[model samples]
Target: RAFSLNYWAINLGFAISSAGAGFIAEYSYLAGFLGEALMTLVCAVLVFLKVPESRPEQAAVKTVGGKRPKDEVRLTTVLRDGRFMGVVGLSFLVSLIFQQGYVGLPVAMGADGLSSSDFGTAIAVNGVLIVVLQIPVTRFIQDRDPRRLLIISSLLAGYGFGLTAFAGSVAAYALTVCVWTLAEIVNAPTQTGIVVQLSPA
Candidate 1:
């Protein structure tokens, strides 16, 4: 539930920012940048005012059979956990793949004669889909195996980008975005939940 809420919040922010940035950039790139900076400043102030530290009182405790253990959790111990390291590595690879939307997709679309505004509109599909579908998708997959969901996510993400190779129009690019956005809807919350599960008590 926590992870789902976090995912929803992220997508909500994305939707608003992406759409706003598109319109703002049409007027002036400098204004768009300044607006973003102002929003960041606002968010920082909100966090400082409203957000509380959530660190556990016993930072070094371990979990045994879903119960807390008294042992201290060390950075060295976390680094030594092969499973955690593997999860982290896989997450990094997934992030690299996802970043292509921001870095490579716009360039690719521009090369195909699309404008920056067009790119923004197309990419906004990602945020829109996540905002609309994240909760339902989370509920659907919440009871399923995280590993299986992640595998499906990996495949979806791969094929989502792969389909771009055949894209020649904005519609084609938007379709590709839809495919990967679904993967993100499935992958993000699951990844966060997994990390929570893997963390020490």
Candidate 2:
């Protein structure tokens, strides 16, 4: 339930930001960037003011008592964990693939003679669908195996990007976005949960 809410909130932010960026960019790209920077600063201020530190003094004291290792050694231990390292590598690959939506997709659309706004609209479908579906999808797969979910999501993600190769129209690109967005809806929370499950703490 916590993961579901987290995923929902993430998508909600994405939806708002995607649409807002599009509208902002339509007026002035520089203003859009400035607006994003301002919003990021506001979020940082809010976190500084409202969010509590997760690391407690007790944890530091326990570490001093040899219940926990020093930071450098702890990082070494994490690096030595093959399973965790594998997960990190997989995550890196997935992130590289997913970033194509932002970097490559827009370029591809532009090459097809589409405008920035059209690219924005196509990408906005990703945020909108995830916002609408993430909670329900999270609930449905909450009890399922994270490894299986990750595998399925990875496959869907690859296939979704593959479909983009054949895309000729904005609608086709949007369809591809929908495909990968579902993969993202499944992947985001599932991956986070898996990381938590795999952590020593």
Candidate 3:
């Protein structure tokens, strides 16, 4: 529930700041960035003040089937595991593609002469679609095997990037963003779940 709380807090804080900015600033972009920075600072302060460490002391020493290993599971062991390393590598590549598309999109749309409203509309569409589709799509795929889901999600992510290569308008860009956003929703939760499952018993 922390994730949901944090998400709502950030969104509400930014919305309020943006509304205030609309009254005080001539340009929306600068106002938005200022709002973001201020909100980030506030979040940092709250985290520093209120958040407690959640790590469990026995996490590394879990005994499986009555056998206690000589050594505790360490960060280095987790990082060195081949499967875990593969997940980290895949996650890095996914993040690169996601960030590049997210950042490059505005430049691409602007180069095509799209206005601020058009870009904002594209983002709105992305947000709306993600909200409406995420749960239903996830529920439909919930019963599928995790490995297959991972593979399919990866392919969908690649397809999203491939679509971006050909996007010439705001609508096309929005479509690509939706595809990638869904891929992210599918991939992220499953990966995290698997990581938790794979932790030493």
Candidate 4:
């Protein structure tokens, strides 16, 4: 629930800011940059005032090993955890694929003779679906097996983007966005839980 809320806020801010920046840029890029700077300053102030320091209490014992002795989470412990590192490796690969949503998607659509507006319309579906479905989907998956969820999400992300090779229209692109957005919705919060379970205290 906490991670879901965090991700929700991130996507919400992104959606609003992206739309606002587009309009602001139409008038003046300098004005858009100044506006962004002001918003960033405001965010910095809020975080300083409201977000508390989470200094996870750690014992002074400086032991180095693959095994964590009881209620202890150190850098070496996390580094040595085979399962966590494996997930990190796989996540790197997934990220490589996901990045194509930004680069490859636009290039492919442009090759298909779609305009920038058409691409924006297709990508907007991602933010919209995430905003709409994140909370409900989080509720549904909260108590489910995390390993299972991650495996499913990974496959969903792969196949969802894989289906993009066939998209020649805005609607088809939006449909692919919907599929990968589901993967993101499931993956974001669930992956956090897995990390905490396998790594954090």
Kindly list the per-residue Cα lDDT of model 3 for residues 1-201, writing each as its tens digit: 223233334434443443354344446667777776997899899988999978766455667888876576678778778887787787788777766554776677778887665556565554455455555666666677978888888889889878877888877978987887677667766666666666654
- lDDT of each prediction vs. the true structure? 0.87, 0.86, 0.67, 0.83
Candidates sorted on lDDT, descending: 1, 2, 4, 3
On lDDT, the candidate that comes out on top is 1
How far in Å is the alpha carbon of 33 misplaced in model 4? 5.1
> lDDT score of model 1?
0.87
State which candidate, 1 or 3, has the greater lDDT.
Answer: 1
List model 1 lDDT by residue over 35-93, tens digit each. 78998999999999999988658555457998855466778778988988899999999
Return the lDDT, model 2, position 89.
91
Pairs of residues clashing in candidate 2? none
How does residue 130 of candidate 4 score in lDDT? 80
Single out the weakest 10-residue window by summed lDDT for candidate 4.
17-26
Q: What is the C-alpha local distance difference test score of candidate 2? A: 0.86
Tens digits of lDDT, candidate 2, 1-201: 688687788778887778677667778999988888998999999999999999756533345566654543466788888998889899999988899999989888989988777887889898899888988888899999989999999999999999988997999999999999899989989988888888755
Clashes of each: 1, 0, 0, 0
Candidate 3 pairs with clashing backbones: none
Model 4 over residues 81-141: C-alpha lDDT tens digits? Answer: 8998988887788778777888898889989998766776777777778888999999999
